[model samples]
Target chain A: MIDSINPTAKTVGMLIGSIALGFTFHWQLNVLLSLVCLLFLMTSKRAKLSTMVRVLIPIAFISVSYFMTGWLFSSEQALFSLTNETIVAGGRAELINGLNLGTRILAFGMIGISYSLTTDSYDLIVSFIQQAKMPMKVGYAILTAFNLTSLIQTEYEHSKLAIQVRNLPVKGFDTKPLFTMMVRMVRWSERLSLSMEAKGFSEERTMHRQLKIKRRDIAFAAGFPLVILGLGMILAR
Target chain B: MNKKELTLRDYLLMALISVVFGVFYLLAVYAGTALTTVLTPFGLGVLGYEPFYGIWFMAAIITTYLIRKPVVGIVTEMIAALIEVLLGNMFGVIILISAFIQGLGVEVAFAFTGYKKYTYKVTMTSAVTATVLTFIWTGFRNNYLAMDWRIVLAIFVTRLLSSLFFTGYLSKLICDKLDEAGILNSMQTREVHDR
Candidate 1:
């Protein structure tokens, strides 16, 4: 179900859910969304277990860090004082605030994982160009650069080898190789663009893959957030 | 210098710049996350990412200064975010929002300089603008308002310094190197010859 939905729709739906998640600090909502996103990913089986575990480990640490920060430095002491709440209640509010911060990270991380793990890069760009009205030039440039990533890595390695061959001190953060690669990049970009123009690449061309908005897209886009909102309201105490 | 139009070459250059920095941003994110874990017990985890905040804006600064065009900062930032998403960033869609806001801030700062001054001061100003805008956004998204003012102040200050060094000073240094290598000149010459 997750994989078959349009990439753009998944992106739009997740983005809406995230923005809505930003406006409040309700721990319940955060936890619910996080759990739902995790379940969604698990059921899809698109993400490998090892990858999920690796990503979640860092996320869990970061979320715990956020929890500690929120607990230690909450600015709501005035509210606790003015309301005349008991110390225990005040402590509970701080705990809730911290939990909210912690779980918010989990929710966001899960949402991001779901979108990235399931969506293909080429498909996403196609969706952007065809369904989202992105300019052809921008879309193609991105696609080209995306293709160049591996080449870029290879070039960097070659530069590093060249430096080692020259018997120069190779630091981890040396900029010489980076600058050399960048010069090559300038040349490559120019040649690529020229070749593209020579091949009569223009905006008035047909796409081989025409990504369209389907019923599933609409259902996911609208229903994802609505379900979250509806659940939040139902769970509101 | 009627070279205001963004040609395909310019877009491709922006794409390349974003791709390079996108990789760097991921490294920074990992480093920062590790640091955050180490510092969580001290309630200073928010400060962990501050040191890398400058790297986040490097693409925007370099693109604007090198391209010297309107909206290059914002566009490059957006492209960087897109690439990161494609590279499987765990922050997800919120990063897109940060990209827009940070890019807008960089654009506004350079716009203040009329896009003509590529000085250290100008880059620093651009970095500052981006830092403040993104900090405010983070404040809301990360619930900084709920944190103590002292911690908030500390995070802001560290971020400001990081931006000044990494985004402003380092990007200017890189651009200077590029200029010295005559790479930028080649770009301009090609554009002029094409016309």
Candidate 2:
């Protein structure tokens, strides 16, 4: 409820953080961004270590798969052969490979965790639209999406239990039933959207936020480019 | 049969399942190489299910299973795959192609059944569909033929089982659970196999 207030700082922080770490895949850059995320997690009273851990588990898998796939796919120069004729795959360590995809994911996850921790979804969207010049339509759409994340979680749990209690052998997926469910869900969202429209709840939101681009906001936004530049230089050297 | 419209609750359930499964997928990958590949095949075997081919099997069947709308599953899966691509992976363009082809495969399963029924058989059918489409992708990527055909066949079978067990059955279980909990509207429940 209180999330209806200021959420600009955290959103801004997330933006700054992701841009710094999202794309380029250098171990040094990843280490740096990860450390920054760690720093925020450690210092931000709002941040929860458990939630961060939850997000990290997937990131870890994704990155490893990236690496493992590289290993399996390698037909390049051999580093050193074992007693067997199997030679080392030299092309595996390209830092920017998919395995190191943790950068954007880390950025997104950190941003998500940081946002959830620091501010409620309400404030986050409002601040984005009103303060940051993010279009009100996009802001509200995202806000609504975020707001319902928990609801989605609950409903899923509910359906699972119902299936179990029915004494049905609800174990494997059939293309038939799964599709049936998705169609149902989309319909509901549409109805809800329709209801919102009927109530004159339009995407025509005109709430202009009043956050000034403070010195800190400017500095924060500028920081990522400079860091990327510095890292770029370091890598070149 | 007509495609049913789901409530927010339905989407949330699917999203939650995706999230948890994603976490589990990560664990599987970690288990694969982090002393896991050495253990059971299940631990890190998912590592083989990279952003490319595996997603097709996953998204096709998954989206198909959850939405029941023929192309929706494929399309949503494609969107999800695009999201992954935006995040970047080893096979960039390949991911998009797999999504399209895989979506086509899932769509085919629905088509074969005439979209007339939703049952475990169809799920398995689509699971196989996903496997076959993915086989083509693997063949294209040279992942299939490069390894021994026997080993490749073994991988395909393992993926088939995983799809059946995890992607196929689990999706239905989770959906049914959500449906009964009153979280899913009675209407949504009515669209599929009624309990």
Candidate 2 structure, TM-score to reference: 0.49
Provide all candidates' interface root-mean-square deviations. Answer: 1.9, 9.5
- The sequence of per-residue lDDT tens digits that candidate 1 reaches over residues B83-161 is 8787777786778888999999888878876787889988888888988999999987887876778989999999999
Candidate 1 chain A lDDT trough over 10 residues, lowest sum: A78-87
Where does candidate 1 clash, by residue pair?
A: none
Give all TM-scores, in the order shown.
0.93, 0.49
Which segments of model 1 are wrong by more than 4 Å? Answer: A77-90, A232-237, B1-3
The local lDDT score (0 to 100) that residue B46 gets in candidate 2 is 32
Native interface contact recovery, all models = 0.66, 0.00
> What local lDDT does model 2 show for residue A201?
58
Tens-digit lDDT track for model 2 on A1-237?
112224564444444444444334354566566566566556765545775576566555544543443334322221122112333244434323323333443444444444455444454446656676754434443344444545654655555566667775544332333333454555555565556556665446455445445666555556645676568567544
lDDT of 2 by residue, B97-132 (tens): 566766676677677876766577776677777778
Native RMSD of candidate 1 (Å) = 2.3
